[model samples]
Target: MAKDKKGTKKADSSASARMSNKDYLRELRRLHVEIVKLQEWVKNKGIKICIVFEGRDGAGKGGTIKALTERVSPRIFRVVALPAPTDREKSQMYVQRYLPHLPAAGEVVIFDRSWYNRAGVERVMGFCTQEQVVGFLKAIPLVERAIVESGVILLKYWLEVSPQEQTRRLEARIKDGRKIWKLTAMDLKSYSRWYDYSRARDDMFKATDTGHAPWLVADSNDKRRARLNIITDLLSRISYEEVPREKVKLPKRQAPGGYREPNYPLKRIAEKF
Candidate 1:
C-alpha cells in the first residue's frame, strides 16, 4: 500500500468507491441486523461502549452517525450532540460537561463531536487559548486511559473528507432547504481555514491517538461507503455475539366486547397527501 504524506496508507480507490443505492441498502440491512445483535448483547451482558466522532465540517459525521444508530434502540444507543458550552460550563473544567454523558452499564453512548473540540475547532477558531489547547492535548490521553481502565469500550473516529468533496457538500447545503441549517456562519469561517484545521487535526492525532484509545480514520468522500465502512469498523472493534432469544409469537387480541365507538365530532386535519 502506498503511504500518503501523513504516513498513513493511502485508501485504495476501489475500496472507498461509491456504492449504488440498491447495494448500499442491501449492505445496510445486513449491518443493521448485526447492530441489533450487538445492542442485545450489550444490554444482556451490561456492557458499556462509547463512540466519539470527530471531523471537519461537511465530512459526513452526522450522516455516518445517523446510519450507525438509526436502526437501534435510542434507549440503548444514545446520541449526544451537545450544544455550545454554557457560561457555567465554560467556567468549569473543559471535560467536565462531557464526563457526565459517558456511557453507563448496558449503554452505547455516541458523541457526534466530543471533547477534542478544544484541539480542533476551539483551537483553530480561536475559541480557546493555545495554553488551554496545550493543556487539553496533554491531559486527554490520561483521561482516556482512565475511561478505558474503568471498563468502557471507547472507539474514536475521524472522518477524512477531500477538500473538493467538502466544498460540494457545503455548497449543496446552501441550495437545499433541509441542509441549510447545517451550513452556519461558523461553518463558513471554518471552511476558510481548511489548512488551519488540517494542522490542528494532525496535532490532535499526534497527541491523543494512543494504544488504549486510538483514533480510527475513515475515508468519507463517498457518503454511502463511509457510513457502511464506519459501521462495519465499529462492529469489528467490539466483541459481541447475538444474544439468545426465544421465538416470538403474536398473541390473539380479545374481542371488542361490545365497546361501542364514540360519536363525538373530532376535527381531523385534511389528509392532503
Candidate 2:
C-alpha cells in the first residue's frame, strides 16, 4: 500500500480501471475455494483466529466480510457486528462488550467494527470524552497482547477510500433501494467530519499499531481489487494446507416399491418473476 505526503494511504493503481463482473467473479470463486480449505484447516487444527475490520462508511467492509465468509461454515467463521451499545453495555468496561465475542478454539471471529470505535467514531463524534478515547488508545494494545498470548491470531484491517470515492458511494446508497438501509443519520453526520475522522485514524494508528497486532491498510476505492487483495493477504498470514478428506460417495436412493404418488392438489403462490 502506498501513502501520499499526508500519510493517508492511496488507493491501489488497479482501482483506476473498472473491473469486469466476469473477471471479478472468476477470481472470487477461485479464492472461495481456498477459504473453504482454510476453514477446514482451522477446524482440524483447533486454531483460534480473530479478524477486525474497521473503516469509513461505504468503504466495503461489509462486502469484504461477506465474500470471506459466504462459502465457509457460519459456525466456524462467525461475524460479529455489534449494534450501538445499550445503556448497560456502555457502563461496562470499554473492551468488555467485545471480549465475549472473541474466537474460541477452532473458530474464526470477524468483527465488522471492533473496540477501535473509541478511536474513530466515538472520539470523532461527541459520544465519548477525549480522556476516554486517549485512555482506550493507551490500554487497547495491552488487551490485544493478552489476546495473542492466549493463542489467538489477531488480524486488523483498515480499509481506506478517497474522499471523492466515499462521497460517491454514500450518494449511490441513497439512490439504490437495496442500499438505503446502509445509509444512517450517523453516517450522514460522519460524512461532513472527514478531517476529524482522518486525524482520529492517524492518532489511532500511532497509538495502537503494536508489534503484536499491527494494522493492515487496504485501499477500497476499487472494491473488487480490495476484496481480492484482502483475501489473498489474509490467506497468506494463516499457514494452512488443505486437509485431505475421505471421498464422499452419495449412496443410491432406495426404490419405493408399490408406493403410489398422492394426487391431492395444493395451492401454490403465483411466480412473480
Candidate 3:
C-alpha cells in the first residue's frame, strides 16, 4: 500500500475482494465486545474522548459510526451531527459552536462531521472566503493543541473513498428508498466538484494534521473493512483497561401479595410482524 504525504497508508482500491457478510459480522461482534470494554473503562476512569469524522459525501461516516456505537450506551457514546449553523451561531467564532459539544469526563463524543467544515465544504462550495479559510487553517492547530492539553483524547479520521466507489455508493443512494434521504441538493452540488474537495482536503490535512492530534486516514472503499479497521485503530489509540465487574445472581422475587389482574379494557396495537 502506498503511503500518503503524512506517512499514513492509503486505502488500496484494487487490493482485495469483498469481505463475506458472515465473516464481517463475526469480526464486528468481537470488536463490539472490545468497544464495550472501552466504554466501561472510559466511564470508570472519567476519560473524555472526542472523535471527528470527515470525508466527501457517501464515504460511510454514518455507517462506521453506527457500527462503533451500536452496542454502547447512548449516555456515554454521544454522536453529534450538528445542523447548519443558525444565524446566531454563524455570528460566533467557527469553533465556538463546536466547543460546547466536546466530551466531558466519563463521556465519549463522536462528531459525524466537525469543525473542519470550514476547511472542506465551506472552502470548496463558496460558503466562506479564501481569507477566512486561510485564517481558520492557520489557527485551528493551536486550538486543537489547547483542546489536547485540556485532556480530551481527540481522534480525527478522514475516510478516503475512491471516486469509482463513491460514485457507486451515491448512485445506490439514489435508488435505495431507505437511503434516499442521504442524497441532498448539497450532495449533488458537491458531487460535481470532486477535485475541489480533494484540494481542500489536502490543504486541511497539511494545516490541522499535527503531532498532538494527527489525522488518521482510512481506506473506505469496502465499507465493512473500513468500519472494522477504524474501530480497531480507535481502540489501539486509547489506553483503556477492562474494568473489573462483580458477578451477579438475580435476587429471588417475592410471591404476588394478593394482587389480582384488573378487568379494565386496554388498548393494544397490532403486531404486524
Candidate 4:
C-alpha cells in the first residue's frame, strides 16, 4: 500500500519478490493446497479456462506465468506461445493457428500473445495492412463473444509499464544477452512511436472491451505483486467447489519397499560441475 517518492512500490524488492522466508514457506503451502483443489475441480467439472497475457517486451510475462503454474500440474495448465507463422500457416486464417492451444474440456490455456496482436502492435508497426488491422478490431468483440458463448471462460491481462521503465528494461536485456532477440527491429521503430502505440492501445480498450471479456490492467512495474495478483484472480475466477484434500489421489510408486532404489549417492556427493 506504500510507495516511494517515485510512486513505485517501496517495499517490493522486485516485480517478482513478494514473500519473505517465512512468508514464502507459508505462501507456498497455501498455493500448493489451492492448486491441488483446483486440479481436482478441473477434472471433475470439465471446466475450460482461457487466459491471455499481453504486455510490452520485458514486462516479465513469462516470469509471472512461471510463478503462477509453479505448483500446478503441467498436464492441465498449458502455456501457448506461438512462433512466427510457417508458409502453410501464412495461408490459413490467423485464428486457426491458435485453435490447437485452446483449452481442452478441463484445461487452462494461457496465450502469451494472442490474435489480438493485429489490433495492437501489428497496427502500430505496419506489420499488417490497414484493412487487416481494422478488420481484427471490428471482429474482436464478436470473436470473444463467440468464445465465451461457446462456454470458454476468458481472462485478459494487460501488463503495463511506464515508457521510461520499458526503455530501461530493454537496454538491460540487450546487455544481458538473455532476451535481446525480443527487441526486434519493429520494437525499435515502435520505440519512437510510443505515443502512437499508446493511442492504439487506448483505442483497443475502447473498441473491444465487451461485457463478456473484460480487461484487467496489471501494474507490472513490480513483477511479484503483479504475478501474485494475476494468479490469485485466476485461482478464484474458475468456477469450482471446494475440493476436500483427503479425497485427492497421489501417484504411487510400484517399488516393493515403498521407495526408489538408491542409485543416487546424492547425500554423500561432494563434486561440483
> In candidate 4, what are the lDDT values of residues 176-204, reduced to their tens digit?
78778777887788778878878888888
* Model 3 regions lying over 4 Å from their true place: 1-16
Query: What's the TM-score of each model vs. the native?
Result: 0.93, 0.93, 0.93, 0.79
Residues 81-154, candidate 3: write the lDDT tens digits.
Answer: 99999999999998999999999999999999999999999999999999999999999999999999999999
- Could you list the CA RMSD of all candidates, in the order they appear? 5.8, 5.6, 6.3, 5.5
- How far is 51's C-alpha from truth in model 1 (Å)? 0.2
Which residue pairs of candidate 1 clash?
none
In the range 117-188, model 1's lDDT, one tens digit per residue, is 999999999999999999999999999999999999999999999998899999999999999999889999
Model 3, TM vs. native:
0.93
TM-score of 4: 0.79
Model 3: worst 10 consecutive residues (lDDT sum)? 11-20
TM-score of 2: 0.93
Quote the lDDT for 145 in model 4.
91
- Model 3 lDDT at residue 157: 96
- Candidates 1 and 2 compared by lDDT, better number: 2
Please identify which of the two predictions, 2 or 4, would achieve the higher lDDT against the true structure: 2
Q: With candidate 1 superimposed using the best TM-score fit, by how many Å does residue 129's alpha carbon deviate from the native? A: 0.9
Task: For model 4, name the residue pairs that clash.
Answer: 15-222, 15-223, 15-224, 16-224
